[model samples]
Target chain A: MVEERMNTDKMWITMGPQHPFSHGLWTLRVHADGEIITDAEPEIGYLHRGWEKECENRTYAKIIPMADRLCYSASMTWSHVFCKVAEEALDIEVPERAQYLRVIADEICRIQSHLMWLAAVGTDLGNLTVFLWALREREFFLDLNIRLCGQRLTTNYPRIGGVRNDMPYYFERDCMRCVERFETVGLPEIMKLATDSSPFVGRMQGIKYLTAKDVANWGVTGPAMRGCGVDYDVRRDDPYDAYGEIDFEVPVLNKNNPKGGDAYDRFLVRLEEMYQSCEIIRQAFQKLQSIPKEAPSRVKVPRCIPAGTHMAKIEDPRGESIMYLVSDGTEKPWRLKVRSPIFVNVSSSKHMVDGVRIADVPAIMAMIDMCLGETDR
Target chain B: MTEEMIQAPSYEDVNKLISEKFGEKVVFRTSTKKNVKAINEKRRIFLSTDRDTILELCTYIHDVLNFEQATSVCAVDYIDRVQIVYHLTNYFTGIVIEITVDLPADDLHIPSVALIWEGANWHERETYELFGVIFDGHPKLERLLTPQSYEFFPFRKSYKLRGSE
Candidate 1:
């Protein structure tokens, strides 16, 4: 004889598709028992734009613009990645001076991108002051981008085998000023607002803890993996562009070290990464200043790639972005496959959200910092 | 973790090993244009065998050749035949190997490698749904990343898009 059990009530809460804090158009169907979430299911494809199909229709030159949309914040990086792979398939060598300029533009983009993430994360946490401060500081980097490429977000600065244009005489000086300001004034205030605040620390610390083993197993990269204490940074491991020539450190948080992998660890990593990016920019800027301003920044692209396949991997701010190019000896590629890092990083969201409070979801998701454009591309 | 431990095997060694490991079953070998000197050199190997040997080849690749990660699994459709391409990469060595099996367009069936590498689960499902390739032994073989009610295999050359149709 079995005794009858009482049916505990369960409430369904939907957070996304239009929510301000939610990343892109993802809808979270979470089952809650009282205040705690018992189960959660992520519903995607709300922001799918069929970029892959679109790529097949466009020429190689035209596809760079679409790559810009994939990760809008990191437009130059994606464009560079796409163009680099295309160039590799064509066996075209990018000029040394052009590579330096590319590095400068990419580093500037990284600085602005991390600033945007900081602002968004702060805004999600209801810290309007920090958001304003971050955006204010970010304007400096945006100005530099405007000076270099004439656009802020979708510059399409990177071209196949080179850049769209050369930098102005004032570019180096202006970039140096931005880096100096970031180090001396901007970063300290942002750090104080984020890490020093008890409320922010309480909301972030120990929440969404991903082990290093799990990070590698799932092919996770970038800050998400660094947040799990994995010291694997693609720039250091697989150098491309001017990264091999530049001097910068790969910031990691080990349990034995001062910083342990957590939301705070991720925050700390990005903070340090900004400084390293600045250092890279300084080196690249110095290199660029030495080169003649009249030097050609664009390469003459061949009509068709050799009949074969070529794959190139670059460390974008997100993670390891692999672009696979297959040419059937035609002007257009037979098949082009982009192995986006956000796709792999976004897969770890399930691990991050487990056992965390419902309110902290926004913070955790923001900390993961996945660009839906890259994920769905 | 050390570079010396991760030996960068030449293309000749790779071909010889494949020939030795699976004597008659081994079909042909082709080289990819992309080569990473520091990492494992990239190569594409084509295997012609029955459906039964699919699992055995995958096992041998994973267990012996040390193709630890399954990068992607995609199917390409030709006029009369379909080909399933398994793109595998070794993490430490950075070597990429493509194993392809050709099948008739009428009967596009191949065994799944999901049991060996869990990452292949979604990829195989995607291939199955998009190319209409049937995987014989895929656990929980369901449509992934696509709508449940999606009627047509959109990826196949024969399946035309809205404008083309």
Candidate 2:
């Protein structure tokens, strides 16, 4: 009976498999009653290349590059997770120097990714300043990546047990300089743009809130949870790599956000995270210096990984990423499973966007930092 | 290796507490065979429970143990039977407890934990499409990461690879 009373024009509209606001290839079929969204359904797989299935065909070492392709914005961390899993599965001990180096690479990737995300978020909200300014700083780190790893985006840098190369000559000075600029100059400007403008704050502040309960129930992690004032970071809690030795604070919402984590708090979280990432790298560089000069950068890994089921989780800039692997006593894995954070993060949008204006959809969606490369994988 | 005595700081306590609290409901509990004390504490816990008891167990884990998120739902095809594994974690403690519910080939159905963890929704759908496991209570158990019209379970062992005969 209610169905009969509904407006004839009320129907499900496909937002995008190719919408400008969509960061990647995915569609959102939102059921709306005029401009108010009654329901939202996210559809992914437009970019699905079957990364997990493909991993079965590749050797243990060969899959490192494949891992990088999962999330290009933060490729180092994805590959780092795989390397950590493979290392644990093989029972190989990574040297202290290598662990410190891996921390340096992963934290640098984290900052670059957050900047790229801030840039993408800026572009979505029609704020060109954030977009340009964020990337301007982002390029600095990208170049530092080239200096450190010889590639820009998909750096197949971290080998199974250790890094491919040690800190290059002048790496410390160059990296510290980038760190200082990001903390002192680059981040302040972005935060100012986020804070100063009424239009930006008007759109971002109060609406599209996901509560702490929702973050927990949705398995949301990274900036998404911290935005809601729930402090959780795998670097500190799980302490993989040199995160145990590193001292840093997990930043949360200082905006007195009562509606849980809104788009703005998540924004603040990422901004502060960029600062924290710098601190980690700065301390790690000092630790890197204390290590003996003759330390080996790469450790020897066996040609084949033994048969076993293994799981490892890492805090990606997007969220908590976990990989489940089953090896069949061979060079190739029997089954490889990726628990991409974007997949779960996107799913919760159904609840996230409800009761909001149709126009606010893009604003809410982009804040979760959707990387469909990881999601569809 | 220069660093010795890697600290895992009592992850085993979580497993022990869960078993003591929900022993009758749990079907099986096991950890990593890696056995190196440092690695052992970071060991993955595999808990088995029947379809009837899964929802209850999930509620216990989420409500009581504070494993706030259902990180991923993994389905594995073992030829004769399929195993549906739910990796749940307490972000505060980094305590990961993976709950597995095995379904025979004839009955590829299990109760969905989506009711407990909203994050499990898409994960269950992805597992459903790739491994052919039916998540009975999932509100929308649709295929993700594949063409909507694609009919094959490509991740299953039955799917012939290009190099295979």
Candidate 3:
């Protein structure tokens, strides 16, 4: 009876288009042996809104607002990248003040984006306190977003040549306050709840491992790639906007640790990145002070772009976001392609989660920081 | 525990090596826009090659040239012909070498580079589904985002978008 009851065959378990751990609408079909996941396949595109194809219909300027919708959490960077590409196609330079403003806005987006990811990771690991604390800090950054731009989540602030508007009254004061508080008090308190907790570390440490070679081969970028020991940050290496002038350390997990590139290493990379973003914001604010307040922030550009192909890339909070623009000397674009980091990163999920326990799937995948709006777009 | 990373090839070195290898078959052009402030615009490199030897050319780019990442794989429908564009990047230098393969509209078949670098797998698949450019030798060439039953390649210039004449 005992021999007859034992089963030898492995089972296929389907995770979600609607599962709680997904954080978005995507399905993961995993081949399992009791508890260990042998193989995994991810099915995305549930949030597909034809983002690339739609850009072809609209004129160059109209797409900036649409780009903001790509990722709600990092809306500033999305719009900034679109503007960067259009700026390249037009072959124009952003003003000195605008470059600093873009950098400040980008770091703001990065901090809040990582905070949102932290909140998601908290709930994924079944910790309510971390969820609440991370979200509370994120609220202040979102409020900063409203102070600079008119919108909270979808900020259509970046224009083709520069930004939408100059800094509002006392915007720098408010931004500096928020960044300081988050760096000193807000981040440390949240860290005590999550990073200092043994249970939180226990759930994440040594779970889903991807070597540096595997990361490079799969085209993973941002914190996920840095977590795996690849010291490539577009902000530092490529240096679009004001990043070339600003000085900050990019945290990589492989520096001190021999066994890095696990879920926990990725976690540490993001946490350290939040701290670095604070430093960047502080520096950008100082640089802005050097420039006159009357200095131009927005440049007037033409409606039509020249007939040529141009590309621009920016270090998004998630990864390296690139845009390719093909123009036909018309008001509208001939072809526009968005190289979303999450799209390529999500494709490598199979190699990431393989051989990990089924219960640890959420923790491993949460390191990816899935934002379906960008992924599906 | 520190692994040795490959040093990225400079733009001059990359251009020289490709010109030597492919000779007259490859057309090399450096982007020169007058009075541009962005670094990427002045530094961008473009290489035009035919679809016949893209696999071989890309293999050399990947294996010999040490381009670690296929940054993007996208297709453009140019009415009479289709252009399959692959942007490969060397991380150490932050340089992107864009390779464009011109395919006749009648035959949109090109050899897949997914086997060379697994990162190009989904990019090729997405290109295949949206533009109907069949990437021959792709492991799984199924529709990624669109409905499987839909027979139209929505990104094709011939297939008109809704509310547009």
Candidate 4:
């Protein structure tokens, strides 16, 4: 009976399109032998709305609002990238005030997006306290979003040449306070519960590890790539907007560590990134104070873009998000292609969970911070 | 070449290397936009090559030039011909090279670079399904966004969206 049991063939186990850990409509079919997974395949595109084709119909200005819908958690960066590409096509420059404003808004979005991911990781690991605390902290950042832009999630704030508007009266004070509170109070509390907890660390410490070589080969970006000791960030390496002037550390896990690119390392990298985001916001506010209050934030741009193919890349909360715009000297774009980071990162799921056990799949995959909106689009 | 040049070659050096290797077969275009800011943005290179030489060109870029990542592989339909663009980036020098290959309407097949960089696998698949540009050796050239059985290439100029004429 023992010999027969050992000789059983591998079976394929399907997870999601609706599973809780998936956090979106995508399936992961795992080829497993009892508990250990031999291979994995990710199937996405449930949220595909033909986003690229849709852009071809709309004018340049109208596309900014639609870009916000690409990712629910980090909507600001999506719209910023769209506007940046349009600005590139037009060969225009953003005003100084708008550049600083975009930087602050983007860092806030990064912190909040990472918090959202932390909350998802909590659910995957059977911890409700982390989920609740992370979401509660994320609320403060979303409140900042509402104050900057009228809406909360899909911020139609970034315009073609600049931002929609300047920071409202005393908006900087409130933003600074929120960042400080989160840094001092909100972060410590979450760290105490999650990172400081032995059981939580034990669950994530050594599972689903990847090497630096594997990460580079598979085109993983953002914190996931940083976790594997790849010291590249689009904001720092390929600077855009006001990011070139700002100084901040890109946290990367040391490859020498045995648990270097595991779920825990990725978790640590994102958490540290939140702290860095707070620092970036603080510096951006300092720079904003020097610029004249009445400086023009948004510039007037032509309705039609000249015939050109331009690309703009930004450091999104999840990864390096890029927009490739091909204009045929018309009001409407000829073609607009989005190179979403999650879409590429998710392709390497098989390598991510190759030798991991079945029960560890969710925790391992959670490090990706999967956002299907951008992926499917 | 100096040690620093070998490790992280400047854009000019890489351009020289490619130009020397491929000569007149590849046409180079540099895109530089005027910016009002004090610190100007870097210029990006766009190299247009025939589809026949893209595979070999990619191998040199990966092995010799050390462009470790294929940031994107996308196809644009020109109504007359299809253009496939591959954006490859070198992490060390932060240089991005945009390679474009035009395939005539009748011949939409181009060799795949997914084997050279595994990250490009899905990108090629998406381009195949949407633009109907066949990547000759793509490991899995299946539908990425649309249903597998969907016959139309929605991104092509011929296949119109509902609201667009």
Best by lDDT: 4
In candidate 1, what are the lDDT values of residues B21-113, reduced to their tens digit?
Answer: 678776765444343322332334445555667788777766666565566676666648887777665544445566668898898888888
The residue pairs found clashing in candidate 1 are none
Q: Write the per-residue lDDT of candidate 2 for residues B9-57, one digit (tens) a residue.
A: 2465666666786787786555445522335546456778878888878
Query: Model 2: clashing residue pairs?
Result: A16-A27
Residue A129 lDDT (model 1): 81
User: lDDT values of the candidates?
Assistant: 0.73, 0.82, 0.88, 0.89
| TM-score of chain B in each prediction | 0.80, 0.82, 0.90, 0.90
CAPRI-style grade of the A/B interface in model 1: incorrect
| Stretches of model 4 off by over 4 angstroms after superposition | A3-7, A255-260, B1-5, B36-43
TM-score of chain A of 3: 0.98
i-RMS for every candidate (Å) is 3.8, 2.4, 1.6, 2.4
TM-score of each: 0.85, 0.93, 0.97, 0.97
Q: lDDT tens string, model 1, A125-183?
A: 87778889999999998888899989889988899878888887777777888899898
For model 1, the DockQ equals: 0.23
lDDT of 3 by residue, A284-326 (tens): 9998999999999999999999899988899999898999999
Winner on DockQ between 2 and 4 is: 4
User: 1 or 3, which is superior by DockQ?
Assistant: 3
Ranking by DockQ: 3, 4, 2, 1
In model 2, which runs have C-alpha deviations exceeding 4 angstroms? Answer: A1-9, A254-258, B1-13, B21-44
Off by over 4 Å in 3: A1-3, A255-260, B1-6, B35-43
Which of candidates 1 and 4 is the stronger one according to lDDT?
Answer: 4
In model 2, state the lDDT of residue A321. 88
